[model samples]
Every structure is written in C-alpha cells, then in structure tokens.
Target: MYLVGKFEHSVNAVQLSALLDITYKTAWRMLNKIRSVLSMESQQIWGEYIEVKHEIFNQQALLSDDRLQKERSVAIIKSVKRDENNCSSSFFAFQLLSRRKQAREVLEHSEQAEILIRLNLGGHSSVDMNPRFQQFQKRNTAGDLVNSGKRTCHPLSVIASNAFSWMKDKFHGIGDKYAQQYMDEYCLRLNASTGAITCAFEHTASLSLQMKH
Candidate 1:
C-alpha cells in the first residue's frame, strides 16, 4: 500500500519515512530501488521529436547571507515528447562548474537533428514539430542539423510541467546528483497514465535489477 501510494505522488525520503513509520535509511533504500526501476523503464522508451530544455535551480550553498556575492546556480536538462504522439518524456541532470559553457555543451551534444533524421527515416511522423525541426527534416546538410537542437527544442509538455511542479512541491528543493532519479520517477508516472498502471509495474518488474528486502 505504501509503495503504491508513493508511486502515485511525489514524496521525498524524509517525508516517506515519516508517512510509513519506517527508518529513514530503509525509506531511502526503498525509494532508490523504485527510482532505479523508473529510470530503467524511461531508458526503454524511444522517440523522434525530443525537446531538450533546461531548468535552473538555486544551489543550497547560495541560500545563506552570501547570496549576492556571485550566487551559484545549477541547471538540469529535461527532454519531452520522445515519441511521435508526444506520449513520453525523459530528463537528465548534469553538474556544471561554469555556467558559460552549459548552453553550448547541451546544444553540441544533444543531437536533436540526428534524432529527427533517424526517426523520420524510420517512417515515424513527428507530432509537435517546431518550424526549425521541420526544416531539419527537409534538409540533409550536417551544418543545418548541428547546433539546431538548441533553437528547435520546444518548452515542456503539459504533463511534464505538472510533474516538475509536483516534484518541486514535494521535495521543496532538488539536488543535482539525484535530479535524474526524480525526473525518471515522474516520467514513469506520466507514461503509465497513457495506459494501465499495471503494465508499468509489470515492465519495471521485468527488468533484471536486484532489489533489497
């Protein structure tokens, strides 16, 4: 009952521990296991139109009195509409010491054009393609495709926005290291809504990741 309830909502380890009347360590372990499954399930989802966007969060170190003196900021990458119908989304969080290179690095590596080309070649129609994405689809030049993902990537889907809001409310603040895990959990929930929740559970169970007691 606890696991199922937790799956339905976003609750951090501390809150989950208090809710279940269990030790914090045990709660953390259980949440980690579940998050692992969610991450695995997200990896299995493939799509053509992936919108990569970044969200900025304030670092804990900058919360104190020294807030004005070059406050540190962290950015996380989130991808939405992995499939043609915009049914799935995925998120990734990366740590950066320098903010100057964050946007450039994301654009250089995400390969939005490559994903679109491969999917279009594979015969999947893009669902919510931006104008730039359409241009990439029509053109074959490497220069046109490269560095275009940054501009073509749209904002988050409605479901993704809701999930992020839910996570933010539940956790108060998210850390850089575990942002991916939390994002995966939200993705699983969003994906499960397309069909039956049982199927999502079954899919996670099929993965060979060993779980603890």
Candidate 2:
C-alpha cells in the first residue's frame, strides 16, 4: 500500500501476488485480511519540507507480463520546498548532496522555497494533476534535473523509484500486506533521511546508560 498507495493507485490481488511471488489465492485472502485490520483510523505525518513525486500505471500495466508491459509512468516533483534549518534542510540537502560541491549548492531555492510553497498551497492527487504540479517541473527545476529538462527527473519520483528498485531487487515480489510494510519502511527512510535515525540510536544509548542527572 505504501509505495503505490503513497502514489494512491489501487493494485489487484493477482498483481500483488505476482509482484510478491505468492499464489493468487493467497494474495486475495491476505488483502482482505489486511484491509480489515487497517480499517481503523490513522493520523497523518506532515512533511514540513518535501520533494513529492507521483507516478501512474494503468490497469493494463499491472496486468501485463514484466517484459511485455508498455504503459508509461509519470514522475512528478511536486513542492520541492525546504525549511530554514538544520532540520528539514539537513535531510533534504543530505539527499541532494553530490560527488561535487555544485550539486550541494544547486536547487537551493527550488528545494527550500518553490517546492515548499507548492505543497503547502497546491495539494496534489492522482490522475488529474494540479496546475502547481506542472509548475517548476523538470523544465523549471534546473539544478535538480541534469541532462537538461528533456527528462522528467523529479526528486520525489527519483527517490521513490530508488527505494522501490531496492525492494523489488531484495524481495523479488511483495504481497499486498507485505508490500505495505516495505512502503512504510521506504517512507520512514525518506522522511527520516536526517537525524531521526541518529537521534533514535542516541536516545536508546542514553536510556541504557542511566545518565547521572
């Protein structure tokens, strides 16, 4: 649910089964079970600064054999704004940091200002895109996309793709419930690409020490 769900596209049990290398019947049974479990309410974790990307795959895409698929995936780099930090930017910038200094300095505004404004005001969803979504896209976000804007290389899509690429590689496939788990891990990694991991480990160590005062 997380990867495709974050993108807000529905996946059938059969497709989930193939992706996860499980039986079709098993996938169908598990999907219902998991959805029932998740019917309870949930809270949203707002991303104060984000580089959100959305991709779409039609039904045919999901149903086709991997080698036979021909559907297109559109990656949107929506609201790539950054917050004045040591917090948001620390993670945002770290993700953008490159082999050279130029990459570090590039997209400074796009990351902090333009992207931020859009996410806060624009509101993106599946299928029909927000006008704001089109703004500062590959064409406008110069620093972020190399080889010119000829390619649609939005940050959100790029990061998500990399994460999914890893998941597909490691697990070969994911059942719907399991797919959701992997997606959660991906979101946490993306959202926590900064100090949360370190802060968490440090907190654990501090608790273990029983610090004096």
Candidate 3:
C-alpha cells in the first residue's frame, strides 16, 4: 500500500487506513514505524562540495512567546559531486534543531562548522577552504539566514518550500514533536528515485531481524 501512487505524493494515515482497510490507529502506527526506519536509513555522511542553508517552517510564529515550541528551524545540506563530463548531481540531508533551541544560536558559524566536521568525518580539507562554506560564513548573522530580506527562489529554497507545503497539505500541518519524522519521510520520498526505497526496505528488514534476536 505504501508503494501505491507516485512516490512524491505521500500516503497519510487517513489514506493508508482507507487503503489497507485498517483502523486509523493501526495505520498511523504502521506509517510511523516505516518513517522511523526511513529516518535511520537516511542518516548519511555527506561530503564533496557541500552547501548548507537554513529554512524556517511556520515563519509567522517566530515572534510568538512560545515560538520555540511552534517554529521549526531546519538546516538543509546539499552535497554535490561532478562526473567525468562535469555534470553535477546533488544529494540532500535535513537536520532539525531541538524544540528549545533557537535558529540563530544553533545555525551560527560554530554550529555550522560542527555540522561540517560531522559530515566530513573522513578528514577532508579544512572547511574554511571550501567556497560553499565560505559563502555561509560571509552571512552577517545566522538570523539573516532565516529572515533574509530577499527570498530568492533557488532550487534548495524550492525544495524546502515544497516540504512545508507537503506537510500542510497532506497532514494538515504537523506539530513540533513529530515534525522531524515527517521531514525524514519527505527526504526519503525526494530521494526515492535514487534507490532510497530499496535502502529503506533493507534497513527495515535488518531492524526487524535484530528485534527478533
């Protein structure tokens, strides 16, 4: 049932329940389990000319007293590699800040450096030498990354915007608690054409076998 339609169109609990002829609770649990497996499978270490940017979901709520609980700050990292013909292909990863963490603090220069170190643990050159990293560092402030005056509609921005729209349209806007899981689902779906579904199934089977032992 999960593999039913185009991979881009996610199967929500309501749709899954109707398709599988099961109770909503059961369908929700099953979908969550699948999303959990996908999240685990998608935890990849990115390298080679990585580009990092911040995207905020629910921007209108950023100034609210309970903004920390309502606003979601995500770091979108794109890793690009060039082929023999100088053609480039990109892979993406998304990381969300903890509910209590603010974007400005967590997406700052130091934090971005930490993320780069983690992604390039294979001991690539100093991140400072990376032009993409330099571009990120040149930003006046982390806050500007999230609340920039000019909203250029770049590819990464379009992906982030689509993610927000997907969540709002499919699930009627997810809460902070399970937002990351939904983000994982979206990432997996985005990469589905690149054999991500096979990887997710393999991870799911491995997890099931481990549980049996």
Candidate 4:
C-alpha cells in the first residue's frame, strides 16, 4: 500500500497481498489468475468500429545481422461522454488506431474499416509510416516527446491522453505482457459512463465466467 499510494495507483499484485496480509507469492498467483481474464483472449471482437486504434501494433521481430531497433507501442483512444439526457444511458465509445500503412492494409483486409472512422480524420497522422527504431539502455523520459504546448493540445490528443490517464488511475501501469488485457478491461469499465459500477461489475464478471468455462 505504501509503495502503491506513492504512485497513486491501484489494481496490482503487491497491494492485493498486503491488504489481505497474504504471502507475496500467493498474492502474485491470485492476481495473475484474475488478471489473465483481462488479457487479449478476452478482447471482444465486435467488428464494430475499425481504424479507431490498436492498429499501431503489428510489428514482427526482425532477424538482426547487427542492427537492433527499439519498438514503440502507441495506442490512440477516442471517447464520447454519455450525457444526463441521451438515448443510451451510459458509455463513451473508444477506438484503437494504427499508423503504419501495412497495419492499415491488414486492418482493412481483416475488418473492412474505412468508412466509419474516416481513417485520416486528424490531419498529419502518425500512422502509415516506417521509421528506423532505436534501443533504450536506461530509464529516463524521452526529451524529444516532452511536449510544451501553449493551449494543452489537440482534441484527438486530449482524448487519447485522457484514456491513458483513466487507465493509469483505475488500473495502474499495465506491463507489456498484460497491457492488452488491462486495456480490454479498462475499456469495458469506461464503456458505461456516469458511474455505472453495477453494470461494469456484472459485465466483467460475465467475461471472467466465460473465460473460465
């Protein structure tokens, strides 16, 4: 709890054990089991909106003669707030987007998503390009990415930024291996806006049940 509180984070094996006063290993096992349900295997493929996001990840490991490049994982999330007065009681729909041309092509082949998102709704997109990669040897914020904008940022950027903020606040930092699962679960939680805890809980429980059986 001490360590976690320092980071203003939640949903992790460390805190779970401390709260229950259980063994570290036992807590780890339990956390892993529950967290597994949130993994990619549980990602609901609705074929609903394509080109929203999650299109950025489709890279393959390259055979290296000598060159090793760093991999970048960028997911753009868009959301719409459900109002006090609306047809749908809750939810702000979000979409995962991609930037690589090849990624888009594969997405098109798989889901036929070109009309819904308008693909290039935001001008000067980061998708559809191949840049030389680099490797990191240490832990330090990339100065190149530290933005000092005048009026915060663009709308799409705001939405994308907000999604991650919500994820980190509610679920803590999602490690590389379990990120998708965490992401899926987080998306599910935010799907129903205006604080529908009951609905989110039921839906997540249903998902867990399905995964178990």
Best by lDDT: 3
Please give the lDDT score at residue 187 for candidate 1.
56
Mark the regions of model 3 whose C-alpha exceeds 4 Å error after superposition.
Answer: 4-6, 42-47, 61-63, 67-69, 82-87, 99-101, 104-106, 117-122, 126-151, 193-213
CA lDDT of every candidate: 0.46, 0.39, 0.60, 0.42
Better of 2 and 3 by lDDT: 3
TM-score of 2: 0.37
lDDT, residue 174, model 2: 52
lDDT per residue (tens digit) for residues 1-213 in model 3: 234224457788888899889999998998887666544532343435766677776555436566645666677766665657776556666666543465433455566666556555335542332212111222233434454453435566678778888888889988877887788777765654544244544544664455558
What's the distance in Å from true for residue 36, model 4? 2.5
RMSD of each: 9.5, 14.1, 6.4, 10.6
Model 1: which ten-residue window has the lowest total lDDT?
131-140
Clashing pairs in 1: 47-82
Off by over 4 Å in 1: 1-7, 42-44, 47-100, 103-106, 109-157, 196-198, 208-213
Model 1 C-alpha lDDT per residue in residues 1-213, reported as the tens digit of each score: 235333677567897799889999998888877676554433224444334333333322344345433322223233334345655544332222234332222433334444334333234444332212121122224425454344432234334346556767887756556665676666555556644243545655654243332
- Candidates 1 and 2 compared by lDDT, better number: 1
Which residue pairs clash within candidate 3?
A: none
- Give residue 142's lDDT in candidate 3 (0 to 100): 40
Worst 10 residues of 3 by lDDT: 129-138
